[model samples]
Target: MFGPFRLTSPLSGGLLWKIPWRMSRPQKARQRARLRHVDKVVSIVDQALAKKGTTTAAVERWKAEMPVEQEMLPRDKYTIFDRKEKKYRKGIHKLPKWTRVSQRLNPPGY
Candidate 1:
């Protein structure tokens, strides 16, 4: 008794949302710009704090641990490590809120 009146499933199987396999060139450019802006902001803050003759542990740790934009390899800047992904890497954009979050590091030798 299957007909338009019969109810089982309203939709067939298919991908509801498709994510791009990789980022476009313009997106990469924008990502780089954002990285540079973050670096600039950090340096500005450090300078301002120095002028005031004070430094916070957070600022010191950031400078000690994070490599500035110029020092990061393009691979590290644009991709992140994922154990399930082929070649153990996936595009940064694959992560939710990637633009707003800083993903500047991966496991060493990943």
Candidate 2:
């Protein structure tokens, strides 16, 4: 465990891997699909609530505050604000759990 392999890893103060600065086209496509799936789930829930004569405030607030995937600009869809990054932005894919977490919004004028 003290040879070249471990020596070159995080335990030895070296990065084990690096995330790319940009997402590949296929990755972007998958990201889009995930966004669409989330949108679909929200819409379905809204419809269900409508039929039940009740709507949750959280869902209503989400619909009001968040843009649907189709409505987002390319910049918003692909990147997020990062105060430490050059130009104050970074690729969303670089975030941990990018596929599982919702990160569709950023502060205005960033």
lDDT of 2 by residue, 41-80 (tens): 9999999999999999989998999999999988888899
Model 1 lDDT, full chain set? 0.90
CA deviation > 4 Å runs, candidate 2: 2-7, 14-17
User: Under the 3 Å rule for N, CA and C atoms, how many clashes does model 2 have?
Assistant: 0
Estimated TM-score for each candidate: 0.85, 0.87
Instruction: Tell me the lDDT of model 1 at 22.
Output: 89
Model 1 lDDT, residue 97, Cα: 99
Cα TM-score of candidate 2: 0.87
Global lDDT of each model?
0.90, 0.89
Each model's total of backbone clashes: 0, 0
The lDDT leader among the candidates is 1
lDDT of 2 at 23: 84
Model 2 has an lDDT value of 0.89
Candidate 1 on 1-110: residue-level lDDT in tens?
A: 57676643433455554668889999999999999999999899999999999999988998999989999999998999999999999999998999999899999989
C-alpha RMSD of each candidate structure in angstroms: 6.2, 2.8
